[model samples]
Target: MTSPITTSSLPEELAPVPATAAPAHAVALVAEVQPFPIAVAGAELEQLAHRLIATRWPHRETAADQGPALDEIRALCDHWATDYDWRRAERFINETGSYRTEIDGMGVHFLHARSPEPDAMPLLLCHGWPGSILEFRHLVGPLTDPVAHGGRAEDAFDVVVPSMPGFGFSDQPVTTGWGASRVADAWIELMRRLGYHDWVAQGGDWGSSVVDAISRRNPAGLRGIHTNLPLVFPTEAEVRDATPDEQRMIAAAQRYRATLDGYAREQATRPQTIGYSLADSPAGLAAWIYTLFQDVTDSGGRPETVIDRDEILDDIMMYWLPNTGASSARLYWEAERDVSGAQVIGAVPAANPVPAGFSIFPGEAVQASRRWVERRYTTVLHYRQHERGGHFAALEQPAALTDDIRTTFRALR
Candidate 1:
């Protein structure tokens, strides 16, 4: 058998594209139109709400709590249609130094907040499924000016929060292979386009996967990587010697796959089929994503237990206004071939030899073990387990999440 590759001697197959191969001409950055007014008039919101209240829901079987729980759906719809304010959420995003630029033939929207510190570390942040650029809104002020938030200026970072292609203001790419690997390349190009050479990358969920791909490729001038979710598939030995807690966690994961993996299966296999429902009916869209927010988290109560109504609606609204349900879901459709094939290799084995850090939140799909993670990462500087947050760490625990980024990159600095 081939000996395991050392970090130093890892083959060039894992290396990033040569600098000469990178774009030579400074890509002309095209500015996007400033986003429209965020505040929906109270009367307009009321009218939409009234429509939801009077909505004609479809008939279902008596045993069909298998779908979104009716009570939960009704409660969420009521809050969204009546209580949620898009304008407030919009104003918050706008105030955070948001901007847009065209990259790889798509209009890429992002929030670029420079730290108050003159020598602040540059950081690229990404969000995942059922989320928008809005997820990172709370972390911007704290990250860019840590002193104001009762932290050291030395902990400050110049943060870049980009909406992934096919989501939010970013133009949907009409091509194949926009998976984590492709997005990682886009992010590297995005950083270079902004004239930054060295920077840190961070993400969770799909964002986590992209950053992982980016780090694995060891793109030039990349300082390190940080993620809320780590893809740590267990090895044969680890599985054989699993402890009860590990075993229990594995069982929970299996149960989640059985019940919750349907959406992924559909998105991966035939996103367009369900895309029609999501694109057309506001109620249908809400139910599709609302189930994940409810089931994926360890929230003591409902989604409101973790995310505010307006916040939740704001994320959903990104899909609504753009009608990106089909395009966004197509990401899974594109990735389906890999997920279904046994020939697929685990992401860690394919990892680039960069330093990595993790912040594990509750109710995530896979809570990887440190031992498992260390096998892939050359440097595992920080791994913290938080009691309060769930899968949507950026949204649910921005302060804690921001602190994690500050702490992780401190080692690199």
Candidate 2:
């Protein structure tokens, strides 16, 4: 069984988001997108195996199960070091056609796959922390080439999945202010650069926040958006008058904030401080990220029950191979400084005017009733509460997510 975990939950609603603005350090952006494939060297893989084998394990947790169990981690590391195939994961990435380009002084990497159908619409999929572009690896086929995945060609999409800065092959931001808004702006620039004049967007985790920013900007080409984790905070009055179901949602979130959010607190406050362990120790990093899968997935603390062990390893390798432990954690630090840049915890970005769709997974701690979401989105095209799935919806329930995305965009298309 996995330990109970809690992601950062919604707090008292804040002010509406401000208008989009360019970063002070904005520079001449490179007007080109270059091919950037995955090619990890054998020696690097060897080094990772050595590090895993050499990990100095901590003592087992008490029977209370506050975090990943010691025995479970040890076995996972053993398999990771001795039997895991990094090549399979690499093939999963390269097969989709990866590329990178300079946007506002940061190198952003992405996977672009065009659909075979002539009427396919441009679709941008954003992933958050602990999730790389690979999170959407399963959707590329179903969304881009629908006929092959037992779907109609009319539902096909020209999918674009980008590695949020500082996460995957993307370059880490040198200066501060690469917050959620900046990332959203870069995504807009990317779609435009690719000559996709009309497109829709979707995201979860920090990606949801980025999509929120993009919706606020309401660019001419952006037709609408979809989110699995919608960031909707009701008012004090609204809270007081919440329905029985809404009250239950509110209480669960409160419990999450009260006990299960230490990881978020630490990352928001001292990303660099925690970076030392996360960057240096492979085992430490695995346990830290693994807690979420346990706490959040419908698998009831055993993520491998739903997601493949190798696939989980693939997600971890994104952070390990790039040594992005510190860089990716800094996203929270930037947000806490001014309540800006990828803020998920108590952030109050302005309400968006674009039509939006929402899919709330039962395992997700932070949730909103349709009334709650519609108030903010104004034009709610689609809203669903699936009986299964979790925060990592793409990994846990790709088929459901893809179908939801296709369903939502069909109206606009």
Whole-model Cα lDDT per candidate? 0.73, 0.82
Q: If candidate 1 were superposed on the true structure by all CA atoms, what would the RMSD be? A: 10.3
Question: What is the C-alpha lDDT profile of model 2 across 1-413, one tens digit per residue?
Answer: 11111101101121112223433212233347655556677788898899999888877788755788998888888989999998898877666765667778777778888787888999999999878888897888999889998999999998889988788777777688878888999999999988889999999999998998898888989999999988887677668889998897788678778877788999999899999999899999998888888888889789999999988888998898877889899988877764544344344445568999999988887889998886676789899999999989999999999999999999998
TM-score of each: 0.85, 0.90
Give the per-residue lDDT digits (tens) of candidate 1, residues 149-259: 999988888888888888875667767767767777888988887768889999988888788778767889999999988777776677777787667656766777888
Residue pairs clashing in model 2 are 2-301, 17-349, 17-350, 179-341, 180-341, 180-342
* Runs in model 2 lying further than 4 Å from the true structure: 1-31, 338-351
Clash count for each candidate, listed in order shown: 4, 6
Stretches of candidate 1 above 4 Å error?
Answer: 1-51, 59-65, 337-351
